[model samples]
Target: MLPPTQTEAFDELPLVERARSGDDSAFTDLVTRYERKIFRLAKHITQNEEDAEDVLQETFLKAYSHLGEFQGNSKFYTWIVRIAVNESLMKLRKRKTDRTVSLDESIDTGEETVVREIAVWEDSPEDRYSQEELRGILEKAIDSLRPAFRTVFVLRDVEELSTEETAVALDLSVPAVKSRLLRARLQLREKLTRFFRRKGDDVFAYL
Candidate 1:
């Protein structure tokens, strides 16, 4: 949600202020800034396009209605992320009514980890695979993760949220966020490990 430059990031406060003051254009601008990223995050969580679209629409609707309650303690982006994530989680909960385990409360260590160490890739993923292929492999793997782990991975790793920002967005303790993030990375690593084995000193360099 944050812009690359600090100046652009600072601009958000003014936009937020203007939007809070009932400036419709300012609100629209804010939506334009983050709608795609929010949709991706929702899709990552729910793994359903329809649910993701619903979450995206509802997120902005709720944000618009609750602008008065925004305390401005957090960045506008982070606040919106919280709403979006909560909505995505709610969607999953509705679909999983038979399950009794809490999404946030679960200990997600049951997945087996790869015992063999995989070599690091010398080149970026883009150097080896087309963007479409990379995205397909990753999205499919990430979609297999549990909702809680997927949320942590998408916010912390994919969206590059700071640990503190993630904690605030998900309303989790810092320690809990760290633990879940570790589990998420481990899960993703295990999934990706199946794709490229350590044939030599590097990952998939021979190919």
Candidate 2:
């Protein structure tokens, strides 16, 4: 099934009706509409391009199988996001369950990429060279966040979802979402501070 056009109207009703009737093309249209956003959410949560792609494919497949159960109580996009978030969390939990890493060690590993990327974003870029450098740095920094914290921050901050919306998407309580977001921000702040301190020292020495 080909994906539908990027129409701004609420096409969910029609799509849902079609999908409910087992129209494969309608389902395909739905996938086309959301594939990019789903992939991005997966990438941000997983910090791995390969894992993100896998999650995207798995999410849509699962969503397809469960189409009959969809209640249409919410927007289709929101419903899709709920599924994607659950899929990412499931993958993350599975990974953690398979390993036993110390929290301190994990924090150290996460800080390197997060801090480096934060530093890159601050550099004033007057040329293409500088812009490209900044992009690479930011990507690395985003990839450095711990899987759990990274997902929370990306959903709440990067995606600009409301607290309620994030909670719904993650199947988390409002308080849980708030606490996770706070921790993510604190972690990012610490990483960014260290980066700036190093830059400040370099500038002072240069002066």
Candidate 3:
């Protein structure tokens, strides 16, 4: 069934109640409302199309089974995001691989204040590459981030969730979310700067 557009308002509380009462259609409606966004978040975390799809299915299934336990402390969306994040992390653990970039790593800057050095784009790469190509480049850079930083980056920057929302979803404090996001951005900038430099394009300058 087609989901209503964002502009089309519906009372989610009623739908939630209906679904809790075994109204299958109501549950389907709720799925329609959130599936696309949840899939995107899963994809960002899993970094594989197939794994993302699996995560999407697993997330909804778990949510359905645990619906009775939900206490309404946070938005339903935030609750489901927490599930997706956990499922994604489980997948990572099963793979027995480590993918992380350190936040404490510092780069030399002329200023007294310590900070990570990131390359500044001279002319936004938007001017040099097609949108599709730039998107591919950006995706690669994001994928290279350590999972901790990547999750925070995806939630706070790409998904545009608020710091509070991100913190709730990841079960972290707001300050932790902010710290991870800052490190994620710095790592991405450094990566893209190196990429453009390696391509011999004067697109970015290292600061």
* TM-score, cand. 1: 0.84
Model 3, residue 14: distance off in Å is: 3.6
Question: Between prediction 1 and prediction 2, which has the larger TM-score?
Answer: 1
Task: Report the Cα lDDT for residue 146, model 3.
Answer: 69
Per-residue lDDT over 160-200 for candidate 1, one digit per residue giving the tens place of the 0 to 100 score: 78899999888888887888888778878867766544436
Error of 2 at 187 (Å): 3.7
What's each prediction's TM-score? 0.84, 0.67, 0.73
Question: lDDT of model 1 at residue 49?
Answer: 94
Quote the lDDT for 42 in model 1: 91
* Candidate 3 lDDT (Cα, 0 to 1): 0.75
Best by the lDDT measure: 1
Question: Model 1, 87: alpha-carbon shift in Å?
Answer: 0.7
lDDT of 3 by residue, 1-207 (tens): 453433454568888888878888988888999899889888888887888898899999998999888777666777888899888877766665544323233322323223454344556555577888888888888888867788899988876667998888777778777777877877777777655543444444344
Each model's lDDT: 0.81, 0.69, 0.75
Stretches of candidate 1 off by over 4 Å are: 1-10, 108-117, 120-122, 196-207
